[model samples]
Target: MTAQTTDPAAAARPRLRWLPRYDAPRLLAAQMSLIDQSFGIAMVGCSLAAIILAAGLMLSGDRPGALPWACAMVVACAIAYFGRLRLPGRLTEAGAARYAHGMTATLALIGALWGLVAWLYLDVRMPAVVICILSLIAGMSAAALAVFSACLPVAIAFFLPAIVPVWVVFLATGDVEYLPMFLGTPLYLCVLLVFARNYARVARQSIALRFENVELISQLREQTARAEAAQHAAEDASRAKSVFLASASHDLRQPLHAMGLFLVSLGRTGLDERQRQLLAHIEASSGAAREMLNSLLDFSKLEAGVVTPRARPFRLQPLLRKLENEFAPQAEARGLVYRTRDTTVTLHGDPTLVELVLRNLIANAIRYTQRGGVLVACRQRGARAAIEVWDTGIGIPAAQHRDIFREFHQLGNPERDQRKGLGLGLAIVDGLAHTMQTRVTLVSRPGRGSVFRFHMPQAWDAPEDTPRPLAAHSLDGLRVLVIDDDEAIRGAMSELLSAWRCECRTAESEEEALAALAAFTPGLVLADYRLRGHRTGQQALDAIRQQLGRHVPAIIITGDTAADRLRTAHATGTALLHKPVVPQELQAAIDTLLREAATQGKGAPDRQAAVAK
Candidate 1:
């Protein structure tokens, strides 16, 4: 026998027709929420109305079943309402569909019970009492329509059962008097159904719009979070690049610094013209390399955000004179006349950073200008001084004015000329000026000249008690201790110090330093900031001081460009110098430290004598 085949598609189609279809999952969820929220209010309101209607029927001498049916309806509604409240907070789509179906069935059952009142009492009651009962049923149906309109099918399910039963009873009586009542009942239901359908459409549209808005806001927040993460990553990458540049600069400077010191010593030896000329070339090459490395170091430090300004009152005249003396020979060699107009104005700024700014500006002027002169001048403007560097160089074009201060941005040096510099001089000037809370302004025309100027706030003159310069101190018979991890650096320092008539004691570590100190007492300590065995120059200096029972005059020379190293060295309160140091600078620092020590020593003897007396 052939098996009776059931069409699965046909069966599924009938089930799908009964299931409510929504344009979006959120729309379905929203309708479900509305139903859940309004369920309790509708239940209580309809139940009370049914009780009141049942009481009125009894008072008018209606049937016994009215009171019992009304009570049973109220108890059923209470059970359904409270039971839903006990369910889970978040209802799944299938669960919500089941809820909607169950509520529709409950409402229909209540409507059918109300319809039973019309069947039993219409013939026996007075017309006034019957009309009042019908009115109450109509009112309750209206309320249900309004409450359940979020789902049209549910509204139709409750509405048809409530109104149709009354019409059916009127027709069954087969009397013309009940015809008008029967016709009006279906017509009134038709109007309510139309109203309920329109309301359901509007509600669904509003829910769809609300869901769209929520989705848009969620997308925006995700984009904003992504942007912030990208920004943080860029900042981290920039920091790493700066660190790499600093390390490379330090490594490059070490050998260059050693070469410069050896060259200075070699320059003093007697030599013929050709030898001297070749020596000059070597020195020039070394100097150029040093300048490039220094520029890179400055740019890296600025990028690392470690170049802090320490503003103090200081006379500019002495600083100007020093710059003039240092750069005069270079100007003469280039056959460019260099001039300076020094002012006795006391400016408030970090002296080292300000000096660096001025030096870079002046150097740029001399390097770029072939014929005309360069002038360094200070002009007074109210309570500020405008320190200006004027030069008849290859003036920058108006379009390229801002570009000149960018790293490796040069106007006419497309060949990457070493003599034209590494193109970081102006950049350094800009960075230092910014750190000093000032700005550098430039005025120029192509081929005419450029004037780079920045204002410095004038400070009150230093007190009269500021120490005056001591007489020139000699290095003869001075006791010096040199500590360095690099053997080349240690040997170079020993040779240079010995040449100056200093009794130099060299050591590679604290142990060796202490061993040397047993026989010789140092008048000055010069140490590299980083040493062997993870010890720093500061520690070496402290160790030496403890061994001697006195704070010895010390100088820290370093080739480290790390921000932490720079800060640590600065915090030591010692004269710190960067490597590839010029011979003149080294001698100047040494002489200054020794003179200050001598002055302090002179005061000590007087203090000791006073204490004794």
Candidate 2:
């Protein structure tokens, strides 16, 4: 039978077999087990019944002493049950099986005694066939039950009582046919005993299989739990790394910014030609280090999913112009041509972020190309434009093309001149492109060149607006207020402004800034965010503004990467810049602030209403 399901009712159902309703091995084993438990309990009850029956038989003049033997057998069966329960399975199955092998002779002697008493004392006339059948049935039932109950001695004891009846009945009748058939009782009993053992084996195997399945399921659950825990730990470590990088980047940039600003100012003061050249080299090295750090920080932010793209409508041409100028010198120094193919078309959308992406791509193209030109081009594709950087450089291998976009993966080339970079350019480009909802692709051959392209959605229906020109400020005679905690940075910034022909008033603290304001009302105010002894540049600027009794133009330079810093700077209505500021960038910031102040002053008192008008 195919036992497919674990349902009890299904198990109990009948199956087809061209043999007995109960097969030899399985039927005998189950019967013996059932009988063993039932007979043990039944023996006591049967002893009482036998005593009563024998007593009643004696009162009716049938038998008198039969009750004693029946009662003794009952006592024996009870003892067997108790003993079997205590006996270990090792002895019953292994030792008992071996011990019972040659004990049939002793069983025959017991059977002879039982039969003699039944015949002589009871005087019960019994047919040879009935005697033979009864003896065999009783012998096999008792012996099988005893074996099932793990009582090998008791099982051997049953054989004697059962076979003796057949011998007695056969001798009494004096019939040859009856003698042969009656003597065959033990043989028939032994055959059934063998079948009973087979049933026990089948049941044991079924139970084992069930337990094995349960164990397998338990192991699988444990493995799955471990995998989940490992995954969570990996994620936690990644988050921690991002947090550490974010905090450390801000701290490192602060000192670098102070040093660069001081160096910029030092170059302006009475320096010999060689000293001036050395300072210029220092400034270039500083710029490169700052750029690499910024790239790493941006990549970390992108990986942490902290950067949010600020998409706004603006002209794209100015951004393109700025990138062209930025890479022109590098291209010239590398002896490679750099040109803008077509940037005449106007487009819109988060110009700052878009420019950052294009800058990295174009810079990488220029850096990698050995002898050929790098081109930045824009081509209209349907409603959007495809902006591409094409370089005839040592291209990426087919296997490594996609891998290069991952963080910190660099291509190897011994013969080519390679720029030392942080390997974050393409990673940042990929991240920013996704942020802008643009699709970027790379097409290249191993040794030829690479073309990196991305599509920018058109934000304007018409051509972009031309940039407004800024009027140059005459700083020659203007008084500038510089407030910073660092003495070197304050002095350097003062010198830099002085070179622009402005009279600079340097203050190292809020008290000094207030005192400076009392002496001279400055045209522009430049302050560092962090000041000495738990002070801030904002506090100093506020004091200076109050002393001047007017809205003095000011800008805040900071090395703080936290959003709170930017929020506080914006709330103070100050133009802000991150540190490691180049001289030209600082000047541009100052110029822009002054122009805004001029525009505001020439308009209505409500700045918003004036701009709207």
Candidate 3:
């Protein structure tokens, strides 16, 4: 009969819900698990209570079936406890509801059996017996509420059967003496029912909260994994890009080196005003390209550890004024103001490197800022001078504060516009800062602007070291040796050297240079680091020095930017110049090396002596 009534509805309709018939499988599973664990304890307790009640009845010698009733109830409870244990811990919604329904029916049967005491054994005329039976009925209802209240349907099911029979039996006695229990049974059931409904709602809510938290944590872990994967992939791609740039620059250096020399050579020849204007445009474009390559070379030099800072006391006013003059026109063209506050404060550092750092900072400030002005100022703090570059520009977030100093990192430049640069400005600035034993500090707020502060030690006792400006020193009748494997480069270099009125000879290999040495004892040797027959310029210089029995002044020019290559070339103890060298810089380097040779009493003693002075 129970199966016929409950099986169809169990499959078709949900018996448990926080709302109207909205079945929740997870919630049902939680409720069932709670009840399953405690059901056996509850049944054991019921069996014990039944035995106590039966013993009393037997001792009074009134109820003949008391011992048998206690035995029957205990047997039923043992069977139910074992059956409840067979139910699966994990359950489908329908299965959970059916479990609840089955438990409720089982509880009802036990409750009805207890109700039999009220029907057959109760006698209101016996006050002691009546009091004991009433107390047992109320206690059973209260226990059902406490143990099974997580599922409201089961609690109410056990409650109705146990209490209803007592009310019926007492009312039919036709005694006004039993009115209190008849009135009190419904009130007792009502209170327990309310408490059961409230406790079930709270338990369901708590379980749902736990499930939500677990789901959120799972999603957080998944997102974190994806973010880390993306970061690693981006880092790999950046490394690949750096290597490609280094290789491509190496290949283009030879041609660019030759081209720059030929352009200088061509400029010396006669040309009209219109032709001169066109030449200026070409030189301007070449200068821009060379600047980009030089940035990479500068980075390579730093990485190769070839650069050293010579700390000398120098005033900041001159450097700041020069930068102001150079960038003010640019700032004006951009419809923004540019200004500087001059300070006579002397700082002890390498002036050229300091200038380079300041120039990069100023350029970066001008590039990012669209609407507001940039200011360069200096302030004294204790024994240090703090030089600051302030810009009202698009600011960086606090999260990426340190990442901006990493190579090839840029924000808001996804298209990688060359005008915005190669993203190495701040990286170079940071590297130079570390080399100088200073930290470049930044203060920025998103959308407000930024300030970059650089500190230098102030010099008090040291004499001021002013910068020496480069002048056009004549290379007339200078003994110059130009050795290279490429014919075009050799020819172009010869023309450039001859136009400067220098006695220049060209060689293709070490053998050719050695053979030429018989007729021509050149003062200065210029060689390509990577020459024909796998011979490097360093090896050529070594061979030439071996033959001559003296240290002949030489310069090695090449485009390779590998740190290992730079370090290897630096090991030769010769002047090293990267390719695409402009005429002015090339002349300056040659003059500087020649002056050093004159001091050492080697290489064209008379002319080098004259150039040195």
Candidate 4:
């Protein structure tokens, strides 16, 4: 027992155990930062009040050391307060703890200084001065308890030092006059400590709830980002599918175009009735395949949002007449009447897209009607013209009207007959109408007939120059240049052009075409848009024009349904024809370009002279 040794580590543990423990370290750090920011103005205000109090005490002839002690306390408070303000906004748990402890020490020193003032300056004979100084100290202590209550340990550390010294001094005097102050100081400190403890608990809970809310918001943002990425992936896959369909269609159409030309050439070889009938059947089969491919291509383009409408003013009567002439043969072959009611009503819309809509509707009418005829008519409907297609076909039920416009949706053709088409006519019509910002309506009664109609705004201020019909021209004795990548296409075109009694020169590329131009001066150039070695028809035409030193009218034929290829061809300012080009359509395009070239040739000398100058 006499040789017992003291353990310093064990003794220090109990003293440090009195420090408060925080379960949430990060939350404690956040609370400390908030307290520092919120208390800047309060700190400055308290420092000023302390300086003024010290000056008043000095003027009243108080203890000599009181003024210097008060000034020292104010300086320390300013250092602690301003030092916290200069810290980085974010703090680590250890750093926050250090700051809290430092601030607590500084506040405790100030509180103790105030207590000293009360002890040293209170005059036993001057009751009014005693009351004034004691009251001021009590008020400051209450304010400190309220302000520092966000951190309980700091508030407790400050409160005890601020009030206990005054209480002890009053009791030690053993004077009955200061009995109330000694008793009341303890009660006031008790109430303030309880309130500060309650305030600290509430602050901790509030900070924790705010942290949880921040975490939830971060999770929501992450989920939104993932959803947007998935949507972009889906859109990319859809575009890839469209591209695949277009490429496949182009490859298939090349052979179909050659077959159509070959068939026309073979017809001139003088075949018998049976042979002609077989040839007709083959031609019909090829035509049916081409129609299906075209339908699918149209639907894909509309779905891809590449079909831009170029609206303009044009007379409706001419368009109706053109459709009638085009469809008259098929209707006559089917032993049905194709009627069109023409009017001089001018309408505003994209002529190409509007024609497409009408073409699909008229074709549908001709396909579905077996017993009766189809009627296309236009009527003025107050500021708009209503273009209607009425047919006595296998009428649709009310339930099927909406479904009929869906792709590959067929009514009464469950066998998916090729002759009945792929059921995309109405779908294309609906899509085209929607693109033009117009409405298409249907009125039908089952087993009777159906009427499809759409309204176009009237073009009241349209130009007076109406389009004239194109006159057919004979290609006889005309020199034509044919350029294509495929050998079969070149041979088929040569045979067809020869059948028209025209001199034909064939080339497979720009080099071959330019070489051919030295021997033959062609009036017209017909070239495939996609040629050998990745060269385009436009490039070949440009090279030929440079070699010739003049503009030669040209026509571009392509099987590509890709929107970019179509747009490029359209920009060339030359006639464009899609393949499996109908032999008639190809011949018509060639004739148009040749005739245009010849008309411009009349004034060629004047143009050439201008260029020379």
Best by lDDT: 3
User: Residue-wise lDDT of candidate 3 within 362-479, one digit each (tens)?
Assistant: 9999999998899999999999999999999999899999999887788899998887888888999999999999989999998888999999999886655555865655689988
For every model in order, what is the number of clashing pairs? 0, 8, 0, 0
| Candidate 3 local lDDT, residue 422 | 80
Ranking by TM-score: 1, 4, 3, 2
Q: Ten consecutive residues with minimal summed lDDT in candidate 1?
A: 604-613
- Local error of candidate 1 at 605, Å? 16
List model 4 lDDT by residue over 310-361, tens digit each. 7788888888999999998999899989999869998888888889999999
- What are the per-residue Cα lDDT tens digits for candidate 2 across 1-613? 9866586666656553322232233323433344444545554553454455455555655455656765665555455446545544413333343223222333334344455445554332545424443543465455444443233333445544655565455567666666665566556556545544454455455545665877898888888889889889988876665556656766777678778767866765799989988888988888777887677656755664645676655666667778888898889999999888745565666776788889889888887789888988889887788998999999988888789898766676344332458677898999989988886799998779999999887665664455677666556786788888777677667767778888888887777888766578887777888887778887877777677667777777776555445455446656666676777777776666666767787311211110000
Give me the candidate number with maximum TM-score.
1
In candidate 4, how many Å is residue 164 off? 4.8
- In order of appearance, the predictions have TM-scores of 0.77, 0.59, 0.63, 0.74
- After superposition, candidate 1 runs with Cα above 4 Å error: 1-21, 75-79, 82-90, 93-146, 164-202, 299-352, 358-427, 440-471, 602-613
Question: Which runs in model 2 stand beyond 4 Å of their true positions?
Answer: 1-252, 270-273, 300-307, 312-322, 343-348, 379-381, 413-419, 472-484, 497-554, 561-574, 597-613
